[model samples]
Target: MRARFEKQLLTLHQELIEMGSLCEEIILKTFKAIEKEQLPNTKTIATLSEEIEQMEQDIESRCLKILLRQQPVAKDLRTVSSALKMVYDLKRIGTQAYEVSEIVAQGHIVKSKELHVLQSMVDSVREMVTMSIDAFVHEDEALALKVIAKDEEVDENFDTIKVLLVECFASKSLDIEHAIDLLMVSKYIERIGDHAVNIAKWVLYAITGQLDIDGGE
Candidate 1:
């Protein structure tokens, strides 16, 4: 029985990793599409989104099964619960990537200092998502903490981008339609960083079995 339960836990972990990989692919492709000002293959992105949704359902079902059948003890319970929470974060990241792709497909590009800043911010966010998941899978508290600290950087950059976008629209340097699309792309990347932070928090819970009192301080 113990061996079987361990196998189940390993399966859950593998599924989560697979889901993370899919999300990473979407982010990378979306970034490329945006940088090149070319629309990504919508068919491929849509298929990946569907796959991510299915993975989330599978992970949730397996977690429920583990809870019902094995009745995991304290540490094991935290592991399963953390897996459940992490999947939700992963799904949110996938959604954000899809939003980015949609904005790129709209064929809007703004040439400004703020555009460069926003691009850098998006790059950092993509790295955060990858590192956060790595921390979770490896149970590395140091990496998890790094991901948490990085969230502040994302927020700062987001604020700068938001202000610039507002100025662009207000000053007539950018049409409202283009400004709105760029704003949505920037916001999606920012939200992806937020989801990365959430995943890092779940990693902390999985490792220490205690929720961070200050919400991942």
Candidate 2:
């Protein structure tokens, strides 16, 4: 029974990795669509988000099954419980990516220097999500801590964008509607970064039995 349970845990880990890869693909597509001054493909992003939702449910069920049938103890129990917690963060990341895509579809691209700044933030968050998943898969607490620290850069980017938008408003230089839409997009991206940090924190918990590193950006 223990051997079977160990196999199940490995399987769960692989599924989570696959789900994380899908999310990275979705975000990549969304970002490229915007860079080309094209409306994001909402239908495609939505489809990916739906797939993530299903994966989350499936993984959660698998975790619960192992907990009930195997009654995992000690480190095994922590691993299973951490899997449960991380799924929620992963689901939110997918949802936020979809939300950003939706906003991009609604937005008519604003020609501003601020757009480039926002793109940097988008890139940072993307890296965070990727690294967080990698940390979990490899059980690398140091890498996980690095992911947690990267959130600060995301937060800085968000604040800089907000300040730039406000300056545009004060100078009467940008469309209010376009500025608001971009602001919303940046906010979604920030939230996605927060979720990534949450995932890394759970990874830390799984490995070190510590939960204090989730101090937020």
Per model, state how many residue pairs clash: 0, 0
- Residue 195 miss distance in model 2 (angstroms): 0.3
Best by lDDT: 2
lDDT of 1 at 182: 77
TM-score of 1: 0.91
- Candidate 2 local lDDT, 90-176, one digit each (tens): 888888889888888886656678789888988998899899988988999999999989989999989999998889889855687
For TM-score, the strongest prediction is: 2
Off by over 4 Å in 1: 212-217
Each candidate's lDDT (Cα)?
0.82, 0.87
Candidate 2's C-alpha runs over 4 A off are 213-217
lDDT of 1 by residue, 1-217 (tens): 9999989988887888889899989888887876675778767887888888889999999999999999998878888998888888888888778767877777766466777877788778878888987887788999999998998888898899889877876785467777787777888888888888888888898889778533421
Alpha carbon lDDT at 193, candidate 2: 88
